[model samples]
Target chain A: MIAALMTKKEWITNNVRRKNLGAHVLGVTAFAGGHIAVHWLMPSGQVVQDNWDMHGLEFPSLTVELPEMAWDEREIHDVFGYRPQGHPDLRALVRNPRWPDEFYPMAGLNAPQKPPWREVAPNNPEQTVEGEGVTIMKVGPTHAGIIESGHFVFSIIGENILHLDLHLFQNHRGVEGQLQGRLIGSVAPLISRICGADTVSHQTNLAMAVEEMAGYQVPDEIKWQRILLLESERILSHLNDLAQIPAGVGFSVANQKALTMKERWQRGLTVIFGHRLLFDTVHPGKSLAMDTAALGALITQLQREWRPWRSLVQGHHGFQDRMKGVGMVRQSDALRFGGQGVVARASGLTFDARQLMPLYHGWHVDYASETSGDVSGRFKVRLDEVEASWRLMQGVLQRYQIHSALPFWEPPTDLIGQAATFSESPHGLNAHIVAVDRGKVIRYHVRSGTFRNWPLLSKAVAGNAVGDFPLINKSFELCYSCLDR
Target chain B: MGKSIQVLQLRHVDAGSCNGCEQELTALGNRFYDMQHSGIDVVASPRHADGLVVTGPVTDTMKRPLMQDWDAVPEPKWLIALGDCAAGCGVFQGAYACYSGVASVRPPDLVIMGCPPLPQDILRQITVWRKTLD
Candidate 1:
């Protein structure tokens, strides 16, 4: 019944388009009316149709013309029930290559049986290799280091690594799968969990998406508060990453000093935000409720406290020696992988989301980028970012004022309109695309900064020795859960 | 003179966790509550030395390894129960594999509260533990 309804709508749409009327009129009507009919020509010369609800009208309806000869040539008929007449990569899209022909009857259809594919290969290539006197050293999904979980399988030829493969995803929490059918408000907590260090940034992006979709306009005060929170998150994360660089190379003093500086920052956050990690501080449509004058006073206090600490770590020769020229990710590689935040900026990519696309009105931000692309360059970039964040916070506190109405705003229900919401997270550009049908979220997609940069970690580790894994890992600092989700 | 201390982290092994506890543990070194500078570092291996900071309740598969790790860490090392899961098994207590919290395997020198205590709370506990060692 649904397919027939879709077919009738497709016929009307095609007929109207053929008569010289605009297809967008029908598209807009279908989108606003809650469903769009998608028409496809089947391989058997029959036209098939499917009705998809237009929740978020962010992406336009697309129809492609394909050559019939290319359809049967590629095995799309085996995987998904229907095949596009022509697709560029016929063999590249299948999830399971080992599955039998009888399993996948058509494109988009269920397989007869689940293929015995390993989620993680235990004796992965990164783990072992055949070489004279080569011994396997397993690092961890859990390690005795200051970093997160990512098991390293290193084939060491007498303390020199011959092969190394990073095994990750031990901490995968299925955040995206948990987000299905949840209200915008309910998904904030889940989004924040994607990367613990960037909680504020994640929530900020989620909030922006919700606000844009609900057509809710947050006040200037709230926007500034969000910025402040985001900067704080950046400072905390950068400080942690900076400290780990020294620790990875076994420079205890610098590690300890960096940790001390980090503690001071966290204590300041706890004093003002009521939690050290700054969880649940910003929510959709809610402006951070704190006295501006008092917060300004606190920012001043942190600045005075952080300066000496920052100088101490930066001045250390031993720290600089280990970080310099270690785990260098060139500018070209950074650009190819679309790396962002301090990592990309350090590699000479000036693609800061805040500077690239300004979200807060009347606020100006200045940041520095370096082209060294080494661990030291990354460290310097983070240090500069932390200092810049501190300055940005001070500026925010000075300009902030008490407002009567809270900054919380709801997404608009209009489907025929276009809205894009963005936030410059600690990681990078966090964008949300929302298309509303009547008053419901038709389509919601979150493009986290971490999602764009994680693959670069594997690339950076390709030629480097086994010892460089931790340094390289810390350099990029990509959040796995964020990307996995 | 202060005794040189090293931290050894143990995975009590919650098969599927909401990850709130893990986040709290990760935040131990962040800029508002720095754990490492205070001589508290989360080491990857159990064989390294010093204290054990365990998060989550013990699961069936994780039970033997948890015991093995607890045994692996050198003697005179402190054992800390982090988060509610480590304290009293929290939400995953009734799961098939999970029997109890960190106490199920070994006694805890410290038990920090909250579903996951804030970084400050974690640092405070570590500081107190260090003082006790002195």
Candidate 2:
């Protein structure tokens, strides 16, 4: 007696319909024989992976009902040539201007030949909105500052932005494609470079997935240290953005002060972790010996430094005046957009990935982060988060000191398989899905906090003054390379 | 004699970095390293710069804009490749989307090393390069 097999679309629809509204879309990606994989997070911190087949047609369109699934579905279409039937604007997301037509890099085993380098990778048939007094303004592929390359198409009437569109992936070096057939252990350095500000978080998340595949249960003592490293990264990343905000409003004094704290912490990270950005703290088997005295002193120094800056930032009328009531994303719009991390939390939709991770259990930390979802709200979220991160680090340090002599958990070299994991990055919830076969990584997919939240940035910019775009942009501080990767 | 010569101005251009170089590059202007005191400035426009301090593996999509920045700068402008990726593509060498490094696009007059060379290293190399202007 054969059981009936329903279509992948129906299965997803049924799941979406039947669930008690606790379900959230994590990501969607196209893989080899596995076709399309839909990642879901339940209210109970459980991750459900639904494997959907293509029914043999190469360019299959798996239309998604949920609005947030549009980005992931379009990404699948861009790189793998799998069309998302219901996705409205499927203009190139990952496939930038120079990416040749009909060349799907990730779909086939053999990569296409390198096309001739051109003087201009023009956005063919660029998207435009025409109306009386609606002026088109193009900002960059190369910006006015030291920022990474990305183009912004702003439709404006005087100072008001009507619609904001962007051109990202100018820096797509084909990381996932390059990771194919590489040894799992050797991929840490490459992963760390995915983005600079969140280097530690990226490496830690990758380590979690790899260790899962290798069947390694990391020791509590070592896990605490990893958490501390991640929290420090959060503080540093928040500081980086904090500094940029002041720069946006021409508040150089505040900007310099923020830079001072950031620089001090990064310099101290080198002394403690052997890498300024904590890029060297990847391997878990080795016991890292950080001096207890230096750790305490550094923590104390940061606390002393951060408190005054925090007060100054909060009290400065000029700075607060510029940030408040600007770049506002209404709660209803935020929910509809399905944003995550700081952006979502600022907008009052509370879902933190830390609640799902087992490493974060047995601690009494406030997970509820709510705000008005404006530039100032994002500012307060980052400020409060930095404070929380430092305290979390202090707790981890205390625990590590108590269990200094515990045996480290050695990762087993014998085990193999795949795992999808989620962890909180400084930007928001960061997801890494990996599969290992014969000592090599066969498939790697990352759905960053930036990928989902970028659209929200455009949404926030709408009906905002064009001059305030930088302040709004800095408030989000999204990473272009992270999404492009 | 106090200082009499005009300071050098280099515009920083990110040609597809992972942004590690950017972290160090941003640090150059802080109170600690203080590139401004050393008679070096990171200008807002390529037209205002004496050199283009480039980073990353020079991804194909960024190649044209990078060349245009070079065209915008005046004659006798130097090119500085400021990390391992820009120096020789580092791990990103020969990837489908990139042109090895800034070297493949245009040979750099100066090259700083390290996955991201430290803020101190980047400043030191540029300080040494600052000597050649005389």
Candidate 3:
């Protein structure tokens, strides 16, 4: 049986040929009950989702045709024990290597086998390009910097990188597995903490899904307040990346200046939202006990500080030399890797969930662009987004009125259906799909922009100077922890 | 306030944090908190550190690396569990991937309790500890 969302056709569920469906896959997902849904972005600028019911726990491999679907399908295999039959290169993704191959965390502990650890396997170097003068370098699950845990296997000839194999999920904290069977509303805090860099996006996306499930309409005051938090958070996250890109180039002056600005912004956020990372600011239905006047003051203070600092860093020739034309990601590679947010826009793909998803509909989102798809392009994208976010924040703040509502998600506690939500975080498109059964979360899956954009880091790194990894990575500024979640 | 200060160099091990703690820990080096003002620093390697700053709930995958990094610190080194998750696992108590708290790996000399403790709080505590060496 085949179902289609293209050509304005209702999902026709019947025995139909496989070749009838269109290409250009945006993402592939498995909802509750192992139903594989393929979202296709058509030529008319409309996204159409086609879903397929798996016969038992097996689905035909779509990765054979669409490489972007690889991660999604691999994740489905790891968590749900659903095998993607005939797929090439199915390996451990969400699961760490130490876990027994049979231990699928999403299978619910009540099923036959209980969750247990197995003895660790010996460390084997991951695959690399092999030939004369080719050397392999491995850097972190630990690094020289105050950064998250992830490893990179780079194959290089002299200073130029031949290829990069990124080994992630090294710190897989089992966030999705942990959320099972918890009350729908109770999981927002945990969701918010999925990754500090993406706190607001995670919470807001979850809130949207749960709100959809409960048929609840957020009041106008709270809606604007939520937008305000999202934009402020966007500024903070992007600022961290801006500071990082400079440090990659050993430009301490710009790095420290950006860091100082970030700290100032975070302190102001704490004054208004009660959390540094904007956590707890976007819980379902609930409004904050906020200082609305302080919100205005914070925005004004940051704007006063931003102008001179921006020009000083952006104009630096040393920083420009390191970033421009380094680590270029082809637009073709961007599309193949399921590029979503910053990377896609920088690489000349006009695919932003902000513009494409219903979650961000009606909001005027102005994004930055760079056709070269180089390190400088990604850096400029973040720099531009910082201002775009500030503008969006001011628009919301101008319309914001103090809302005195109580703690918020699904209050009626009778949520029994499935809903998916998306948000354009500072990182790009952050997504969450949740299914509640009698008020408890039965199935939850998160696909962050980082999860989608990580492969692009390797794609861009090839042929660039090996030392360029840090600058290239910082330019994209993808979150390791969010994807680890 | 009259006593001379000795630097307390530290290395950070992100056992399995959601990155909220790392965000603040990194900010400690920025101009605002400036842990360096107190002669406290986050060194690149454990071999140069006087202590370990551990965050997250000790995920199963990170347990060995965390122990290896902690062992790399010179003797007389202390471990400070830097967040609610590291101190006692906070929201991740029964998570399958987590060992619950840093103590489950090795007991910490100090536990600073914020989901991610404020950068000021983190610096103040480290500065206070640096005085203990005097």
lDDT digits (tens) for residues A170-273 of candidate 3: 77777777888888868988888888888888888888887877888877777777777778888898889888989998899889988988988888888888
In model 3, the runs with Cα more than 4 Å from the true position are A1-27, A31-34, A39-49, A109-114, A121-125, A356-363, A402-410, B1-5
- Candidates' TM-scores? 0.68, 0.95, 0.91
Encode model 3's per-residue lDDT on B23-125: one tens digit a residue.
9999988887788887888899999888889888888888888888988987888899999999985777677777878999888988898988988899888
| Residue ranges of candidate 1 with Cα displaced over 4 Å | A1-135, A155-163, A406-421, A431-447, A462-465, B1-44, B47-52, B56-81, B84-115, B119-134
Better structure of 1 and 3 per TM-score: 3
A1-485 per-residue lDDT for model 2 (tens digits): 12245565666575565233666666676785537777777777888876666656343343444566767877778777876555667877777656667767777643334665444455644565799999999988887678888889999999999998877888888888778777777777888888887777788778788777766777776777777787888888999999998899999988999999889998888888888777768674544677756876888998898888888888999889898889998787677666878888888878777877787987655664756789999888888888887777777777676354666566555437877877888888888888777667777887888888898898999999999999999999998878887
> Which candidate tops TM-score?
2
Q: How many residue pairs clash in each candidate at the backbone level?
A: 34, 0, 0
Best by DockQ: 2
DockQ ranking of the models: 2, 3, 1
Taking chain B only, the TM-score of every model is: 0.83, 0.92, 0.92
Which ten-residue region of model 3 chain A has the weakest summed lDDT? A8-17
- Please list all clashing residue pairs in model 2, or write none if there are none: none
